[model samples]
Target: MTNSPTPDQPRVIATDAALAFLAEIREDHPDILFHQSGGCCDGSTPMCYPASEYRVGETDVKLGEIGGVPFYISGSQYAVWAHTQLIIDVVPGRGGMFSLDNGRERRFLTRSRLFDGGEACPLPLARG
Candidate 1:
């Protein structure tokens, strides 16, 4: 499945790595849910939740699901992302976890690997 964001919003790109990861998981778990949470310093972090219990954030960009997995973007923060295309890639480290990249080389890992079977790396909170 596929969906479009707002007219002014840039297109979201899912990297091959991301697709492969999702496909592997979907083989056993069809109901996969993807979402983003606001991070520290004006950045965002992505998370995958159980399909049975997933909530969409106000600023999330809805990218239709593939292989029964739903995908979304950070609506408010996405605009500020340097690269229009967002690529999800797996970080090369212990505990196999994924990260989000904005195509420009900027990357952010999940706040806690507990959510996605990886190590914990909390994103800095955005200051006022």
Candidate 2:
């Protein structure tokens, strides 16, 4: 299930081009996942990995699904980005170093817009 802001607004969504690219990647790795990087360098890019190779942390926040794949952000990062909606789009450049899309000429980019009053996603990330 996708995590939408305020129960109805999507927290993250993919552009048509990005969705097409995701389809290409899905052909190879049927089960894929995405984690928005919050590191000091190159953190804007969304890193994708096969479901078998990566692990979702207990503190990670599931922003939502883009192109039918789960997208997550770290709890700390989510705290800083709570007022915005993550827009997953395609850009011409290298993807995250370890991401499945590394070699592809196109990469998944994160663009965000701040939520207006009453539009912010305040859902507490459920943890085990």
Candidate 3:
């Protein structure tokens, strides 16, 4: 039996294509995680990295999980994106230089939709 996310549980969702891509990469790099940047070098795309390699800091917020992968957002960025649901998908292009998906000719992308006034707000930070 598959364990799907409850209605109010997931703050993030991954497309089938994105999940397939992540599965392929996980074979080589098992401990993988995603961090959606607000905007910078990668233009706010969902960047994938080895779990131990990327350091989640005090300002980061854990939105939830997608495909069993924990997704985080920088606190400063979270403030701006708090009202929406994050949609993680894959597309044809080069990912961030530091991201594991780089050089694969396909990159993880972030698409969002408003929360319909029912979904929970952004997950709280560990400390204010």
Alpha-carbon local distance difference test for all models? 0.47, 0.86, 0.80
Off by over 4 Å in 3: 1-7
The per-residue C-alpha lDDT of model 1 at residue 113 equals 14
**Regions of model 1 farther than 4 Å from truth:** 1-10, 41-44, 64-68, 94-128
Q: What is the TM-score (0 to 1) of candidate 3?
A: 0.86
How well is each residue in 1-128 modelled by candidate 1, as lDDT tens digits?
22333343323345566567667655665666666555563343556655666666565666445335566756565445423444455444332134223332333333211122222122222211
Stronger candidate by lDDT (1 vs 3): 3
C-alpha RMSD in Å of predicted model 2 compared with the true structure = 3.9
In angstroms, the error of model 3 at 91 is 0.6
**Rank by TM-score, descending?**
2, 3, 1
Ranking by lDDT: 2, 3, 1
Model 2, 11-119: lDDT tens per residue? 8888899899999999999999999999898678899999889889999988888888999899999889888888889989888889988988888889988887676
> How does model 1 fare in lDDT?
0.47
Per-model C-alpha RMSD: 12.9, 3.9, 4.8
**How does model 3 fare in lDDT?**
0.80
